[model samples]
Target chain A: MSDDKAGASPAAAYLAIDWGTTNRRVYVMAADGSVLATARDDRGIKSVEAGCWADELAGIRARFGDLPAIAAGMVGSTRGWREIPYVIAPAGVTELATGIGRIPEERFFIVPGVAYDTPDHADVMRGEEVQAVGACLSGLAPHDALFCQPGTHNKWIGLKDARITSVTTALTGELFALLRDHSILAEMMTGPVEDGPAFRAGIADAAGGDLLSRLFGVRASVLLGRRAREDGAAYTSGLLIGADVAAREVAGRLVHILSDPNLGPLYAVAIEAFGGTSTAIDGQAAFVAGIHHIWSMIDD
Target chain B: MSDDKAGASPAAAYLAIDWGTTNRRVYVMAADGSVLATARDDRGIKSVEAGCWADELAGIRARFGDLPAIAAGMVGSTRGWREIPYVIAPAGVTELATGIGRIPEERFFIVPGVAYDTPDHADVMRGEEVQAVGACLSGLAPHDALFCQPGTHNKWIGLKDARITSVTTALTGELFALLRDHSILAEMMTGPVEDGPAFRAGIADAAGGDLLSRLFGVRASVLLGRRAREDGAAYTSGLLIGADVAAREVAGRLVHILSDPNLGPLYAVAIEAFGGTSTAIDGQAAFVAGIHHIWSMIDD
Candidate 1:
């Protein structure tokens, strides 16, 4: 059966864009988040301009044809194409649509990102709010969600019911990038690595206690001749993740990690901390879900 | 009558040389490591022609007259003048003098350093070993000792009695340097800081656990405005140190720290970790004691 709408055959082709500092991706989803035709562009928010963002969107149109779409990430913020205002977390579906915009080709809504007025400074979320919204819609989100997103800038966000309430970011990926690649941790490492049991051992060490000292141990382990150079980087990777888990020490919370698997070995560690109740969503999936949420809000 | 030799006054003057990768200093001591006439020279091992090392001694003679002297640091190693072999820990007076070297008219012995030879690589300590040797001389040293020397490359040496047994180095200072002056942590920091209570609070955080997560909190605190940038550095500093202490939780071991008084705030944090039972030695005094150890070995 050909479901046609708006003078075209319809597959419920909904478009989603997850754009950030260095990478950009676009996906065509069904009414559900099942990816249809996916396309990507290298010109992320940092490298491209809001005016140029349309050009990247053109790439998606070529793959899936003209369709209704929703966007997330910097795509919706003040720096983005339409400057979608942020919705303070704990906002409802109505608040989520406050800053959504109208795209020329399709009826699109830019999801309202989340923010908080912290004591010292205001903490804001752009692309991540979409993920929380997606999680809420996926029916996978736990009651009190402790979202752990590990990446270049790892974030741990909390959601009550279906709204993001609090969030924190960790420069674990950047720190690891520095120590293993730039600092003495590089010396302990061999260039191409298979990561001996040391990665596991490091995870154990981080779990044993002394997260920061153990983190420092990256240099000390190299200096002490306990680990090789290439392994040192892996050790540092484990150190930060282990420390993250060790620090959070979440016993009963339904911890959810929204991050790239390639970023670090944090997902496994988070699972170890939060136990069987832990759920991990791929960065791409959460992003798509976030887009669907914004699209759903646009019609409302 | 004290080693009375015809017309000879008791060796009233003693010389000490501290030479390392980038800096060298000559100190004229009153046979007790007390500074008398001190001359700081720029020519370190990396900069000096080894053949000129003898001339450098003559230059010392020109500054403080003819005097018996002792040399510490890398000066005695293969990198410096006449290679002084390493002495395994539990080093004694006789074992130390076995590596003695004398320039005509100057009585001296270069202190033997220590090294750890493992399967992959070995770490050799040239100067720190001397300090550990000095630490061994103290009457308080037990069969097993834990020495903490805080600096750019913090050293934590584990000794079995008199012999310098095993050791580890923490890049605590280096991390602080990188974070405060070079990395992301610098972004939040402003002007000079007293650190104050934030320092202790950071330590307390490490003690609380989740070192990796706590480290992330350093950047979060500042970025979120929970802490002042200057205080962020201070807080991060304490967190790193506290993580180290909390990680190395040895219940009954005697913990002794060799550090400059300038690190008083950090020392206060260390005291909080190791407890008041932890004893601290002045870094300057340890330098003197180290040189004395080398000299006594020579004279004996």
Candidate 2:
């Protein structure tokens, strides 16, 4: 089971896992960095009971063979399978590799998340660091660039000289979901969120006032009959994303966006609307690539 | 039963009701503006079953005796008993009184909410208008001042020459609750929210960036051990209210805050922290006074 053994089978491959809050994606890769097999499950760290992660990993190994395993994302956080200290930025794959936490029983290693500790704002990211590293390894990222990972907790990372130098996080997506599902505005949003005029109007509204005030317009617009109730979701989405993008320093920069297909289009639209050029990178591809690169850095 | 009878009993009084989304407060007042008796129930407009508001009112009357009742807040909203149109500002007691919609079967009148319609932002308020008017009649408001009503939907009303000239709203309270109960940050928060250093630190964090970015710090601070998890609620509250207050144009103005006792102290702390002076007014007292002033303006 241990890769350090004197003689290993030819079928042995590295297992790269991105264990996040909601999903766990596993990549089986050969020594030359080509993917051999893959598996995924909804048993994210949030779903696993405490002290049961070892059994969960054993279950995965039962199906995919007990190859040397490396994991990233929330799996390294205190809430995850095991705690790995955050390697403070500016850090890249080398520094991150040095901070890897290990599980002796299963030959498993966890890549540390990165943190930016400053007087103004403090930010941290886990899986995104792997994605950023992957983007760099794949030549999708520039030596100096702004990378955006939009999701529940959207991150705007500043990369320089192939290292993550700075990080900022926005709770835009989470806030939007909270409002859509729990706030008074939920009643007004009854249909699918369309990318139309109402969405743009929400973006425009973000520029007028603070987000706390601007959000109220979602309900007011419907009550006034100015907007259909069905448009509430799109409009709310635009307002949150628009405000988030506007607050960034991306007026004339090429922002590299790593997002799932569902969120990528919306981010691209907002980035363009805010006077920035955006390149959408597939999230899963970047995650796999990043995990693979990290696994290669480990010595047998 | 009716106040309009040719020879009415001496105990007949005007009943003022402030029926909001979560709570219902009834104030029985004499013609001279003194509170005779009061009652409260959790049966807000939201809790009342559809087509049963009349029965609810009858239940209140059955206990307190039939009287000409005037109601405000969400009870007059589209989802309430009957939809009363908003009276656009700049408006005061006269404009609000003129827009009152009557329920003929029950001898009930509902005061209209106020709306601000501009190209930039649209805002609507139902119960806060009653609070604003009450503050004015009670001589708690200055001729030109900012009135802060802190609750689920906190309203900041701009009063000029004894009339509500402008209005702004912040979803601070609502957003705080949603995040505390539903969002990822909820797990970090467990104890009652205290007004302490953590709360002030959160307010300071709010002054640094957009709300979307600042909110993420709540989780990061706890995760990094920079702040205790129990402090999450207070910190989040401070961040929300601080961001809201910081965005307003009320640095030097005297702000009259009409709020329930629980939230009033927090707003006072935030208002003072943001370099503005604030006066706390009892919400129930204001509602009763506001409804009395509007009722007295009615032409019999």
Candidate 3:
């Protein structure tokens, strides 16, 4: 049986492109903000030459129908097609929509990222802002809550009254990858990382403080015949994730996590391990919902 | 004026080899533990083909006169000539001399590294142990005080009554190099790092906790135009060093820093910044003194 609407298909709306450095995901949305079709490819912003953004967009449009396009993420960074200024937090969808930059052709629009700036501290994010705003708009996250977005750069963002208030980013994923590939502990960590005893034990170890010391312990423990070599990766992962969680004030509070299938559950488990409750929201869904909300506000 | 003694050259005693993964430093010492000659080369344990250690030693003997050799560091590791078990902490020159492993030739001896193992935690070190012991034996360090040995694997050692009481290792230098060479923060960290405002600021930031987040801030601050790109490396260095120092209990005590000229003052500064006074001891001097002390006990 066809699962499509019983009547004619809904009219095609704008094409949403989550254009990142090495990959791009495009979603076709109907006028009612429902996704009609979606596709992903490796031809991200980095693959497109500076002057070939027009051709790139045309190719994407040709495959998904000639619809106006709205892109987010690195597509708006300095290295992307055109630089888009970042809107400062305490911002929500309304501010983000206003800060959106458009190409001269007027057919493609790029969303601005968000920045948290202080005299002594500053942080910036491009693609994750859209997903965060979407989570708030979709009611998946409360107006005043903490959201954990885990990735190469894990972001712990705060929202107040439906607007992003603060942003704290951790280099957990990047550091983990760097250590796995290039560190002295690399050889021992060539094993699968799962949520098991070793991982939980690592989380427990993180509470003891001194991450750099703990990192070396990964190698030391194995060398001492106290820990299996295979569990090094999982334990290190737990230690990093645990440190990321423990650094926050998450005692007796709920955290909303926006992530993919792989990192979402892990982050949720880490939050629970650190005495906090969390709910995982699909990242792609949040991005699409966020874009749709912005579309409705602007397309009209 | 001749710098050497006017009499006949002192009889060749033992050749102390600080053997490591990529480089080796050898010192020819007199019976009194005074260095008669010193040289360094790249024929480290890694470069020597397996099962060719005898030939490798022969080559070294060919360069210097055939003398009994005492080796330390990775030379005694599993991948080296022969694996030597590590001695437990609360050890001193006496324990190290007793735990020394010897080759079949009887002319070659390897100093065992030190290990701090508890039911909940474990830490190990190779060449640094010899240096720490030397610092104590040479009267460069107090018997009951903290010692910070900074290097690729920074070690914080505690000594009580001329014996090693505790050991904690941090991957500060290794992680700094890894991030500077590979992480996203690499681009901005191309400039030279020195003792400056940026470095001190990084050390100060480390006191706030959440090192992973602070690491990301190294990049975020630059991207947000709040920090100069050139200062990124120094700032990051300060952060890692600061974190390493803060993790220890050095509020009001004196820390003896065993390090080279480059890292010695830096660690001293970091320790002072973290509310501790510190004294810097020459690393090579400490190593030679340590080996000499051990040799005096063993050769007798």
DockQ of each: 0.26, 0.71, 0.89
lDDT of 1 by residue, B1-300 (tens): 111121123445666777776787666666664555555667778776868877777766666666666777778756687676666544544556676665545465566666554442234566776666666675545546777777766666777655666655556776776676666567755545345688778777766665544565665555445777767766777777776666566455557777656564575455555554467766555666667766755653
- Deviating ranges (above 4 Å) for candidate 2: A1-12, B1-12
Candidate 3, residue B25: lDDT:
86
What is the C-alpha lDDT profile of model 2 across B1-300, one tens digit per residue? 122221133665777888888888777678787776777779898899998888998887776667878889888888899989999999999999999888777899999999988876688998888888778878767567688888888899988777888888888888988998999888876756767897888787787648898788888887777778888888888899888888885677778888668888888888888888888777777777788889998853
TM-score of chain B of 2: 0.93
- In model 1, how large is the Cα lDDT of residue B290? 63
User: Best candidate per TM-score, number?
Assistant: 3
**lDDT string, candidate 3, B164-251, tens digits:** 9899999999999999999999998998888999999999999987799999999889888888999999999999999999999798
For model 3, what is the error of residue A165's alpha carbon versus the real structure, in angstroms, after optimal superposition? 0.7
**Model 2 lDDT, residue A31, Cα:** 78
The best candidate by lDDT is 3
TM-score of 1: 0.74
Candidate 3 reference-contact recovery: 0.94
Count of clashing residue pairs in every prediction: 19, 0, 1
